[model samples]
Target: MIAAVNDETNLVEKERKIDAIRWNQAEELSTFDYFDINALLAYLVKVNIVARWTRLDDKQGREMLHRLMTSLDGKDLINKQ
Candidate 1:
């Protein structure tokens, strides 16, 4: 799966594919945990993964970091679509 992602020539598509893979992995890891802190942690991981790709065009890491930090304070950053 990662090999296929790496083979993608389009940079944006490659990134999106990789993010999808990461999201799937997170979901799989959290599948067994129901309503526990692991579920919450998984949710946060998924959010961060979404944020990473959603803001792919932004070259400034500092701005992205700031937005992620703000999201951590009980605010939904990007809708978990």
Candidate 2:
């Protein structure tokens, strides 16, 4: 009765929160992922995420990040595909 109603309310609120999170992630990518290292770092800190990199040429940097990210099974990068 009352408990059942409360459960449904909680579930709906949880769903709304999840949707908001997905929206925020998409927005962040559009805003930051195409930029320089400092922009990426700022976005990461703001979103409470993490990243790692090495001193390499642009091509090497892309290859290394792509390799590491794929090895992570799409864990924590912009292109999580």
> Which 10 residues in a row give candidate 2 its minimum summed lDDT?
47-56
Q: TM-scores, in order shown? A: 0.60, 0.29
> What number of backbone clashes does candidate 2 have, counting pairs of residues 3 or more apart or in separate chains?
0
Tens digit per residue, CA lDDT, model 1, 1-81: 999988899997887677667767766787667578877887787678756755765554345456445644543424542
Off by over 4 Å in 1: 57-81
Return the top candidate by lDDT. 1
Name the TM-score of candidate 1: 0.60
Model 2 residue runs over 4 Å out of place are 1-9, 32-81
